[model samples]
Target: MQFSKSLMLLATLATGTFAHPAVGRRQATATSAAVSSDWTATPSSGAYSTAGFGSSTSSSGTGVTYEGNVGNPYGSNIIQISSSDASQYKYVAQFTGANTDSWTVAIFNKYGSDGKMDGWYGQACLTFTLAAGETKYVAFDDDSQGGWAAASGSTIPTDSNGGYASTWGEFDFGSTTNNGWSGFDVSAIAAQNADMTVSGMEICDALGGTCSSISPDAATVNNAYTSAETDVGGIGGNIASGPVRLAVTIDYSG
Candidate 1:
């Protein structure tokens, strides 16, 4: 379990780019706020701490590592935020087919504006299975931006630099403190760069602002990032500030 996540990539270390997931937007608050509590630890065992990144407390109530954690920080995936607290956050769900297969998924919190674009928090990964018509919703703090990396195997592949090697479901939420604009996109640059299997993925705001997706073959893409689109920026959605509920479809086919 190598804990170093300083990803050195070919894309710009700052600003917006499809090659990496940047230029994040975050929600209704005047400024981005740190979330605290509401998460319950799972049954698995690992060194789980209750810490949050960037002046924010872990909304899930515990800090986690990418691979060594006992289980998902969000626990049951049915979050425990109070109605009052829920007002300040948006939710996203990962949908899958009706099969009982499992996948490795990890969500990393971006280190704000420190460069080293892959500013991943200590660790944030969730591995689970979804039955028919089942999905799990994960909450995102207002004015927060990060990436959710998913792969089809029990173990997620890593890049040459040991970073997650998979298509990223990048998201940015709006708040009063920030620009108050939300955005989401998909990036396959990591997987392609590692020459690994690129899983298909799609992300769309539940309210239908816009969508970003890529096919499994890595040929057909819509508003999503591909290795060929390394130099591109601002390819994903730029939604107005409000309550955002993004739906991310993994192992996408269409």
Candidate 2:
């Protein structure tokens, strides 16, 4: 399957427009079916991405296309979050952080400008080109929200807007202002369900301890989410709020 685009004149108008399902109605679930390249989903099934920012939707497969923000908002090679504050953010550093080549990574926060479930996150708030071994961070506010950072390239497809689809590292931080918690999980649901490429990815704590990942080599995925496990909950990390620095390895094989 191929993906294309129809960009708007005013970039901010779309702000990576994500539609469908608000936060209160947002629920995660899945199956453990064998993965294939012909994955599809109805409106109420499988997870999909936003149609705003620099990307648009084509209503492919059964219903909607599992897309990403079309363009890189932070330009190329410009990482987001400079301080690397462990308290308000997590780092995608170390644990084989560098890739053989650059991958376009897009961040879709759990909420939109209006603070709702902006679908799969409307704005590509932090979009950039990530080089091999490069370090970057995404911040979390006091709101009861979380989101995902999707990286696509190598074997995946990039739309005309320069957005890459497939391969996602989902996260949520500072949930419950008084007693917040941070959680994370790796997922191949959107891509595998859309019959697109499912690149390997892994996420670990600051010291490369306790991990979750989608191993392309191993026949069995290690503590990660696949199309079959869409409805399956409690499949990720749940840590109390504090300093959290995650070590990420993109295109992981182990």
Worst 10 residues of 2 by lDDT: 3-12
Local accuracy of candidate 2 as per-residue lDDT tens digits, 208-235:
3667888763245877777776655557
Over 4 Å off in model 1, which ranges? 1-89, 97-100, 112-117, 120-122, 125-133, 175-178
lDDT of 1 by residue, 1-254 (tens): 11111111212123232221122222124222433332222112221222221223222111121111111232222232332233234443445543345665677644312222353332453345444345555655443445667776566688776777887777655422223456677888778877988888888766765888898868789988877766565677766655566667877776
In terms of TM-score, how similar is model 1 to the real structure? 0.62
Against the unseen true structure, what C-alpha lDDT does each candidate score?
0.50, 0.44
Clashes of 2: 23
